[model samples]
Target: MGAPVIGAALELLRSPRATAALTTTGAGLVAIAFTLQQVIGWPGYLAALIVLTLLLVASLIARRDEIDWHWAILPISLLAYLGWAGLSLLWSEYQRVTLISFSYLVLVTFVGVFIGLSRDTIQVIRSFGDVLRAVLLVSLVLEVLSGIIFDAPLAVLNIHGELAEGGPISGLVSTRNQLGLLAAIAVVTFAIEWRTRSVTRYVAIPSLALAAGTIAFTRSPVVGMVTVVLLLAGAALYGIRRLPEERRQFAQYAILAALALFAVLAWVFRAPIIALFNATGELEFRLKLWQRVLDFVPVHWLEGWGWIGIWNSASPPYSGLTPTGGRPHDSALNAVVDLWLQVGAVGVFLFLAVVGLAFVRSWLLAGRRRSVVHTWPALVLVALITVSVAESSILTEFGWLLFVICAVKASAELSWRSALSPRPERPEPLPHE
Candidate 1:
């Protein structure tokens, strides 16, 4: 490019609105890749992601000195996970899959780090909200065309909803559950944006409504459950925040104590709890899948079968998985169990630490007096944790990307170098004023 062209590009990036637009566009593309992979097709989604990452990288380099470089770095846990995944290729029974998975991890890491480092917490939320807005809007329009006008599914977007026909609308996303997750995040993000008055009422209200509609129409037990849990958790946080400082300190410990007690109680009554749920036949089928996995875990207890979601037939436990389907045992029906089964105990610790640290930092930030914007991180962590226990979404596309973004944002917030790039100082008011 010529000097004038280069100068024009640099000039364009100097405007905050321009920068935000670019950032939000990048975010939308990533959201599409992570949640609507089947719709755009994986290869297309991957291509868009790579291009976005490169553009973000260029922008980062252009404003290198303006950013707090130390806080701009990747999280240690992410580095550890990447390193472990890369190294797993050595002993991995399925070399090809591991290599490809490692590459995908690299792409996701690049995108996550870019978003986290380039923007502040509020901007991160705004950009992410913009992505969800674009997604939900496009998906809704397409669904209307398909389900209502044409009386057929949106084949290109892979949207099949129960709204007009039977179940929840998949929309641009792959499944009803994923759609519900997107909608759930949209609700949280739009609600926070509204509370802060950061976004206009017109945009925020409709987005929130659309998201809520998904929860209702999808009839996804998980999404409904998430909504309830989030509501109660938010209420609890608000109640705790209103408490006196000394009382709040004691309350925190009490909550922890309560959790510890509950753990023990649940363990003691585990058999009955299992039996109680088994009457519904939900736990029975899931447990059978888990049993199939746990049965062969001893084969690679320490090293694990390597860090790929898909297992090759040659791999021991995967080979032993019955019914002759490659999709067998993809999820242990639990994120922790899935992580352990894929990369062993060490991987679980590293991944969980990443999430735990993020949650802790976010919770602390949200605890500040009248810090409404800070709630974004905490609310997101709530969704991530709620999904982690019941599904392996945290290990998959949007879930993984969202988790990484939260972790990176949390790490940035608590970083020691926050003073390095302090906001531009405001001028003092006139003495008469």
Candidate 2:
């Protein structure tokens, strides 16, 4: 059965239509896997991983030319720093966590490659949209059913704190923050697709609404959602300006309509939002954690205590020894804190450098006055990079998938550029004809 499915995938990949559909579904499976984690356990994760591996193999087989050098380069440099830090045993606990971080990102890189191979940026985005849509749809339906089954108007779930018996479920499969991060990405995807008249976006609309509602229910998604919406609106404005005059007016109308709809939904659901705000508890907890990280950094100033070493001790006040206690919730901040806690200032610098370099390179590529190939995908990748900051998305299947999509998409853009560029004239053949 697996072999036949694999054969069919290869065959479909040969055609643009099938390829487009497959790409969309494939990219989306990442989110689906994550969302269902609550229901599926290890087996689901294994299935997802297997699918990811197949996609990676297919991406390699579908190679138009050589793989992009940058894709390999960025991961390698980052990996080297991680390896060096790991071997040195800088911060014991930090080293342990770094291994998991490394593994997570490796997966994300593989997924990114598949995405990079997509025919266009729209295909990549749509594929991702499909994945998030699927995850959210399933979750929303279940949440509704759960509300009905349990005989409660307001079901509640605990998030990152002590559980209150018989609380709202928050519709989060597992972690409260993850649902928020996923919803944030969904909002961006929905906004983009709704404007373009994609039918799936319409189907996914309720899911997006439910996701926002769930966020309000959980109360952890505000910062991420706010950031994503602001970015989406800005991107929409940029996109509208790029369209032709006749289409530009329509695009503007669509954007305004979508924004209004979102506003109305938020207003209608204001109670849930207010509840979320209340549920979020004190900032003092995170602030206390951040202060500990800051203090740890000056003490370990150089190479760091090593990953394993971090777990061995705590940063004075907050009791940092436990990974579960006062953990850095923000991914970017986590990286910095992790580095300081384990490897030191140098490690933090290198990690940031790698991330910054990748973005800078992608930005430069996007700015070039090339045709459809490089320009749009670069823009989309920049958006993904922006999303990665707050969300620990770098370690998820979604992250891997995005990386693969961008890699192939970027390379394909360059290829299309060369193919479409005007060639020198062939003089004599015309006269002879």
Each prediction's Cα RMSD? Answer: 4.7, 10.1
Q: Candidate 1 lDDT, tens digit per residue, 1-433?
A: 6999987876666566666876787666656663546656678877877777777776776777777765564667777876876887887778778887778777776766766766666677778887888788877777777778787765555566345764567776655666787888889899878876778899888889988877676666667667877887687678767888768766655654664596599679978977874654545666777777776566666766787764455555566664474323446667877767778777778777777667776676566435566677788888878866556777766677777778787766664345666654323222111
Segments in model 2 whose C-alpha atoms lie over 4 Å from true places: 1-29, 32-51, 62-101, 151-173, 200-218, 228-282, 294-301, 304-335, 357-391, 395-433
Question: Residues 135-206, candidate 2, lDDT per residue (tens digit)?
Answer: 666655555555555444322332222222332344443545556556665665665555555545557577
Error of 1 at 190 (Å): 1.3
Give lDDT per model, in order. 0.70, 0.51
Off by over 4 Å in 1: 1-4, 34-36, 155-158, 260-282, 310-330, 415-433
- Which 10 successive residues of model 1 have the least lDDT summed? 424-433
lDDT of 2 at 371: 29
